[model samples]
Target chain A: MSSSSPLLAELIDALRCLPGVGAKSAQRMAFHLLERERERGLKLAGVLEQAMQRIGNCSRCRNFSEEPVCALCASSSRDRHVLCVVESPTDLAAVEQATGYRGQYFVLLGRLSPLDGLGPRELGLHLLTERLAEGEVEELILATSPTVEGEATSHYLVQLARAGGVKATRLAHGVPLGGELEYVDRGTLAHAFGSRQSVE
Target chain B: MSSSSPLLAELIDALRCLPGVGAKSAQRMAFHLLERERERGLKLAGVLEQAMQRIGNCSRCRNFSEEPVCALCASSSRDRHVLCVVESPTDLAAVEQATGYRGQYFVLLGRLSPLDGLGPRELGLHLLTERLAEGEVEELILATSPTVEGEATSHYLVQLARAGGVKATRLAHGVPLGGELEYVDRGTLAHAFGSRQSVE
Candidate 1:
């Protein structure tokens, strides 16, 4: 028996564009969409298109939103004086979900990747500069990833903040919660040891 | 930052219906669709709807197809005297992909599970019986799974074929090809030892 029809094969190929979906998973997803839940499949399509249309870059923070200014940036309860810069909306969401941050966020949308043609301009660094020049922010916390690109972006932002007369800080790096000492890398272990906090 | 917009959240939820897709994977898929592959995402939806509408059960073999009689049953080169019964279209495709089997197939669509109310009628056993009575099938090959339900279904099928005056056969089972002896289970080891064949 042939594994697929033309339409189904096309659908499977398209499904491969999704992150982490390989050929086998794409096939399974295509079969699932065709055989069991056509309604849900169609709904996903509608939602994708709707989201693309409704969710544009937030003018202030570069996060996705339905309007020019997102609800988070428009909220009055958040301290405008404290700004947390994250690499992506997903990272910002994670920090928010952890529930300690009451500051506003500026999403980089991407990190500086010179090889990939993603520079400071590509990451909306000019817009960030404008925000910094506004002088409303007193503290800038860098929450980018610990990767090389993330570190470079964070360093660049820290310098930019200092030049704008704002205090700059970074999220701490160390062994993760419940992580074993044996599994910690040499660089991370050294950093953690150097930055040890006093119990008092 | 909020993790999702309403439309994006809906897409993520809908994507969870696929096999192996959990909350995190669904979220990633939703982001991939909205941010990178909007066209492909929309194309998947269209193709899914089209395939669902076009593909139906083949009248003869009960496999999914765009027509009543599938391409396989409509083919003139296939042997009509031999039939391979399988549990699903995916299984049928797998056997075809493995090669060497050129006979026609009868798809059960499902197996017998009384607890779930999937009885003989649900598995189209009566239709299988009718096909056996037509007398064109000289050999009925059972290719259902080797689970408990699969064993019961195979036994019922073998008995039904015998009563219909047709020769019934099962695929050989034992240690898999190139399998490690130490990993082989006791029952399979016993069966392999008992059924050892001559090298000559």
Candidate 2:
């Protein structure tokens, strides 16, 4: 708070709004920006602003994208007939980093939690059902987190996918208990991808 | 890294340039920024750019400022005859936070490291000597780090201030060895200020 520059203090406060950054960490980061070249700091600021402005949910897959369709959705190399569903953009990134899945992704903005007022409609389950009914999606992979909410979400999606006549499964084998794919090691992720068993 | 969005990867790389921010931490920060409103991200970016463009060294005391003299140097409440010298603006903030010293500051920009080619002139020791000769400053407080380079710089400054007929002292009595003022608690920092002993 005793920092001489008001702008620097404001910038630090804005950065501290981040999930893990505290006041001290934000101060350190502000000092780092001060120490570096003006161009470097400006570039970082520009990237932050630009990303927030341009990126949104892909119209088809609901994954984050700068355009109407995400790169994965647009890529012909990807298997359109197989869709891997995830809870958030972060989870989608983790799966992509594993580099084992050749299929496209469908990002559910949230999981089904009726207690918290998050119902199937809030998770866009109707849209998913419509997508499944198109008959192009042969297999549906449930790649949500291993939390209680995630389990319920996967079960609901699987039932819906099966009723729509598409094969549906959950990721198993290498994924540990209470695991978040984002924090898992790459080898473990690859192994999990390779050894995934049928949920039914 | 073959990420879905190259811009996201770029932002993460930029975030990693911050002190103590590793790749994973940077990714987390980048994602957090991306999740926020575009206006929030732009506000941070704008502050960063504006701070860099507007803030510069105070002409009198060398601390960060938008005007000719920094707030401390320009204020009538501050002891114009006492100057607290530090390695950077952040260090100056730490001293100010202790609230034991109402004095102006001279930022060295960096410490002396002969191996790194940072000699006396590089740290603006000549300007410090000139300031002392101008005659209002009665005390020169060496508030630099406890590192070898800081000690070497302090020794050099002490000799210069003595020749200029001003009292030169290092805040050694309360400062711990191998510790940075930025990380020191405010209580210890105030104790260090209160118990400062003179250096030869």
Candidate 3:
């Protein structure tokens, strides 16, 4: 759309850099900032600049952090013997919130997708190998998603763990808790049926 | 969500200032920027800051502009005898792009919503009245929306045009072009039935 103000056009264009924002949404955001939220918009700009410049990956876990090592990795209270591996920082956060896993974490940042140029090196598997070779970790928990790429990454990590003499485990895939079996998708239902445990 | 990086947390919080962005969307946007679009994210910050600081209302038309007078208001090619009053700059752009109307414009920035503190003064009707009283404009077109607030604002503008001895006209309202009448809303269908136009 043709904008009367060049700056307004520029603002709308810049807003499209955000995920899920398209032309119409970008225009709405730009107009919203101009009409109602100028102060907060300025604050956002300041914070965005700082985040882009200062936020870096954790040297140990590969999670986003301002420091060399993330808070979760640096914390002495968390267990160091069981390491949970996740696809991204968001997945790491999901695990932290949903489960009572008190083990340390290793963020892959991405799955092992050769088509997208992501492999063991891109996932910082060397750092994970060094950590496992330290002999402090007794088990490596693979918490990647159930998608094909996630499964492939988990399989690769399991091999790495086996090479380091650490026990490898994975998150269970099945019909979710509180969900009706009839309402579950076919793949999930089939998986749950195949993995059913015998009652004692 | 607990973020390892304080800057990342702040960026997520700041991103919520954008229209339609909630916690989850903000987190996704922040991570997307940190993971892939760092350069574009920084550029967006710079442009956002410049837009927030530099953009202001046009002196004549009340549209957003970096200059004291917007390009549309300053142009000599547009017909000075005709003035189209719109609710916002976006509407002005819509009219500019969709039609061959080469008249001048007056942007109200908002409609008449007293509870929301948008009065005639806030809508810049006084400036419009002054422009009308200058005797340069022979016709004033009211292109506000068909909503109650928009109608009220248009009614007020009609009176202002009458007082200035200028002809007043409003946009035709009915079922939209290419829209099925069966699917049209009751109120709009009723209005269209009541105001059926004669064949030329």
Model 3 regions more than 4 Å off: A1-3, A178-187, B1-3, B113-118
Per-candidate local distance difference test:
0.82, 0.79, 0.91
TM-score of 3: 0.93
Compare candidates 1 and 2 on lDDT and give the better one.
1
lDDT of 1 by residue, B1-200 (tens): 34424555666787787788898888777666766776777666666656756777887888877877887888888899999999987788778878688789998988889999999988888888999999999999999998889999999999999999999999898899888999999989998999999997
**Regions of model 2 farther than 4 Å from truth:** A1-3, A173-200, B1-3, B36-39, B174-200
lDDT by residue for model 3 over B54-128, one digit each (tens)? 999999999999889887788888899999999987788778878999999999998999999999899888899
Q: Which scores better on DockQ, 1 or 2?
A: 2
What is candidate 3's lDDT per residue for A1-200, written digit by digit as tens?
34367788888989999999998899889888988999999999999999899999899999999899898888888899999999998898789888988889999999999999998999999999999999999989999999999999999999999999999999989989998878999999999899999999
Q: Report iRMS (Å) of candidate 2.
A: 2.2
Model 1 chain B lowest lDDT segment of ten: B1-10
How much of the real interface does each model capture, measured as fnat?
A: 0.50, 0.56, 0.87
In candidate 2, how many clashes are counted? Answer: 0
Tens digit of lDDT per residue, candidate 2, span B39-114? 6677777777777677777777677676776667767887789988999878887888766887778899899988
Better of 2 and 3 by TM-score: 3
Model 1 clashes, total count: 0
Top lDDT model: 3
The reply for model 1, stretches above 4 Å from the true place, is A1-4, A32-39, A52-54, A197-199, B1-4
